[model samples]
Target: MPAVFILLRSLVIRLLSSRLAGSVAQFLRRTISTGAAHIGTALRHVWERIRSQESKEAVLGCVLCILNMHKKVET
Candidate 1:
């Protein structure tokens, strides 16, 4: 999935920069910043801490709590 993002980002930059000005380079500086739909490696993250193990555990805990399945999830 990360590979796919890299390929798509590269392709977008290639095509846009070819027909546009250097302003197209701004695309690289853009980031997703928020939202679950675009979570993971498909987009650039502002920081690794945003998806850290602690955060993952928190999310899993919330999901389990919501579903009333607060049981051990074996890793």
Candidate 2:
């Protein structure tokens, strides 16, 4: 019936808008923070490698590795 259809639509809207649907902000914050922490650690490791007494070729290689990881373009 039309009335049943309207009731179902309203119920779906209410459920989607309610707090029981869960916090999108919380999910975003958690995902971003976790991803940022990983990137921070990776950068730290690369920085330490640069600061160490490694050869110039090795340091350049590390940086090149990072760039290539994202895009495989001819150097």
Candidate 3:
């Protein structure tokens, strides 16, 4: 029946929209946490290197190298 079909379609759309919203929320949360972890790691590494008397130039070079590598991978 037309009424039954319409009801089914509406239910399906609602279900799918809810699922998509959930997926997007999960992706955003994961992205934010991953970014935070990376920043924390970089800060810790820099602090440790500085404390260990590593050369500033060498640390800067390493950081630049990492950024370049990330850029390449992203592309």
Candidate 4:
């Protein structure tokens, strides 16, 4: 009876730990994807501005502002 209780306890612990780890991994993956999307969008906007022959200084300023905003959001 003692051995059976120990086995059951161990099994429950293992299951719980595995579930916690999976949840953490999923959260990190989602966070990374969101950050990547923000950067990609910023870059695309900058590129479009350049292609449109917009002022270089203005484009640079916009990109910098976007980066600053991203940094703030991440923190």
The TM-score leader among the candidates is 4
By the lDDT metric, which is better: model 2 or model 3? 3
The list of candidate 1 runs beyond 4 A from truth reads: 21-75
Query: By the TM-score metric, which is better: model 1 or model 2?
Result: 2
Lowest summed lDDT across 10 adjacent residues in model 3 is found at 48-57
Candidates, ranked, lDDT: 3, 4, 2, 1
Question: For model 3, which pairs clash?
Answer: none
- State TM-scores per candidate: 0.27, 0.44, 0.57, 0.64
Ranking by TM-score, best first?
A: 4, 3, 2, 1
lDDT of 3: 0.85
Q: Candidate 1: TM-score? A: 0.27
Per-residue accuracy of model 4 over 1-75 as CA lDDT, tens digit each: 999999999999999999999999999999999999998898777677575455766777876887688564545
Q: Candidate 1 at 17: error in angstroms?
A: 0.5
Q: Please give the CA lDDT of all the candidate structures.
A: 0.64, 0.79, 0.85, 0.85
Q: What TM-score does candidate 3 get on C-alpha atoms?
A: 0.57
Model 1: per-residue Cα lDDT over 14-55, one tens digit each: 988786765554553344343434654442343344568887
